[model samples]
Target: MKTKFNTSKFLAIVFIAGAITLSSCSNDDEDNNVVPELEVKTVEDLDGSQGPVFFSLSTGTAVQESATTWDIKFNSSNFSFGNGAEGQVIEGIFENYVVAPASGYSADDLAGIGSLYTYTGQAASGAQHAVLPTPGRILVVKTHDNKYAKIELISYYVGNPDTNSEAFINLETRPQSRVYTFNYVVQPDGSTNLK
Candidate 1:
């Protein structure tokens, strides 16, 4: 006896298989497009003027400068990276940055963080003599562990006081300096994708 090919059953099986394959492909596409969340933090009252404060981008915490795990150190707006760490500065809106550059990172140099802010003098005509974060300056760091991070310096005051406010304009009432309020994103997979 010859076996019959059940056309309806064969079509059903083919349709189901195709659906499963498409579902899997769709899931993979979603995963590939997923972006890591951004981490925002403020290192308040660090008083980098008194000493250098170490920070770890990988852990999103301030580590002791002497600790070998630290990735960068902050000293009065002067940022220096740890061993084998490097960084680059780019001019653009922080939210627009997706992928960090793979090269052109300065090693243990001030070239990256040097242009982060502008200090207006007491004798300046208009705005208060405060250390203001440059409008579009962003820092991208290749961490000591070889991971990637993007930093946006938001404020240099304790509470991130409004620079235009009269309170901040007054020297006596000016928010304490050297307090870093910034947003950053670190790529945990050690890839250049900083989004």
Candidate 2:
């Protein structure tokens, strides 16, 4: 009339549950090697001269996208870089007119470039803010979905370095560009504002 506790079955259930939980822990974020830190790399020989060179954050490839298709454009001024494409709007916050390598700072150092962007400057005035490329300038882009990415203009005209036209930039995009990595963000909370 009385039922006995099944320790063996109970242990088996717990083991199975734990395994499932651990297995699910691996998300696309991990499978794709996408971390919270910036996806750092240097892309050279990129010409943002005539029209903007289309760079896909999703695939990390630069293609010739017409005015109708592009992510960021390079101009003689600040408008040379930003989220100027479709999908998630990319915003740029002027960090410093002086460009410095992330390696130059301590691991915990977040000065100058440690701040967040609160304004979505007009696209017309987007990359239009002229900045002196001498010390090199750093722009923190609010990538798709308001996610953040920091980019430094290493050179505008290769080797000797000129302003605009052919430029090489050092980029540290965060997480992953996703399908169009630079084109979108994965915020499920539907929260469009960033603090």
Candidate 3:
């Protein structure tokens, strides 16, 4: 006897196959929904006159990309006067000094000696905004006293963006006022050198 293929059986088989295919596809779509996120390095403050103040970057804060500028802010109170001079000395009097430390002149007694000076000037506070250059490196220096005296390091560029490096400051105390000289280097990963 010859067996006949049933149309209903064929239709049922087709339906089951289509359902299985759709289920597998749906699982793949779910997997694709997951997105990878970028990892950012943490920033730590180095030691200053008072010593190192340990702190971490704010969570969820965006990492400045290469070729882009970023602004970082510090409290005015954080800065200590460089022992070099409180104010300015008089004209033609090299020996005289203004606002000397309690003890005799020592290397560490001066400002910008072992640590960066925390500038408390209006210009310094105003210039906190920064722009990230390609490869992304920036150096900023600021100087200020508790009162009226203040100095600022503005949009100063020195080297390539790829190497984000630490900037240096040469603090010179003059009779009229104090002067700050800024220099910068490129960092390895093209990030700001937080010294």
Candidate 4:
């Protein structure tokens, strides 16, 4: 007896082949030039806090202002705070360091330093606490009257856990040594200012 062909099996094979063909054809239409969207979330610190506050400086301008966030464009990598004694000192550098204007000043201008300043009080009622330790001391050595100058933190130590933490800020300079003090300022945004 002649067996009836299994139509369903044939149809299944045809369907499978058609699906593979369509999939291969459609894949080529995908544009490789299309960039995938990246979702970046801000990570909080270990203390359930946000990152440190940042400030931006105006190039060739003496005036500076506080910023909620810093953009790469107006700020230089050289303008940074050095790690404290606990942290390793950068190679070929001293532990305590400061920045001065590259030009338009004499050796005296460079010689005269200012105190580094930082905040040291409890968080104000409406102020946000900083994740990083604020500077509590400064040593400034300014010899001449204010003509033109530029300065920024290169690195510093935040006090140890056993001791109270402190940050430095330049206040003024004396003849023998730089007279720096640790002082804090309440900013308009209710954040502490550490110069």
**Number of the top-ranking candidate, with lDDT as the measure:** 1
Location of the lowest summed lDDT over 10 successive residues in candidate 2? 173-182
In model 3, where is the ten-residue run with the lowest total lDDT?
141-150
Residue 129 CA error for candidate 1 (Å)? Answer: 1.8
Considering lDDT, where higher is better, how would the candidates rank from best to worst?
1, 2, 3, 4
The TM-score of predicted model 2 comes to 0.34
The regions of model 4 sitting more than 4 angstroms off are: 1-4, 31-33, 36-195
Instruction: Judging by lDDT, tell me the better candidate of 1 and 3.
Output: 1
If both were scored by TM-score, which would come out higher, candidate 1 or candidate 2? Answer: 1
Whole-model Cα lDDT per candidate?
A: 0.80, 0.36, 0.27, 0.26
Q: What is candidate 4's CA lDDT for residue 101?
A: 24
Per residue, candidate 1 scores C-alpha lDDT tens digits across 1-195 of: 999999999999999999999999999999999875755554545455456778888777878877777887877877888978888788888888888998999875573234988887674564566888888889899989999888888888788888888788888888778878788888888887766
Best by TM-score: 1
| Candidate that beats the other on TM-score, 2 or 4, i.e. the better one | 2
Ranking by TM-score: 1, 2, 3, 4
TM-scores, each model vs. reference: 0.81, 0.34, 0.26, 0.19
Say what the RMSD of model 3 is: 19.7
Ten residues in sequence with the least summed lDDT for candidate 1: 40-49
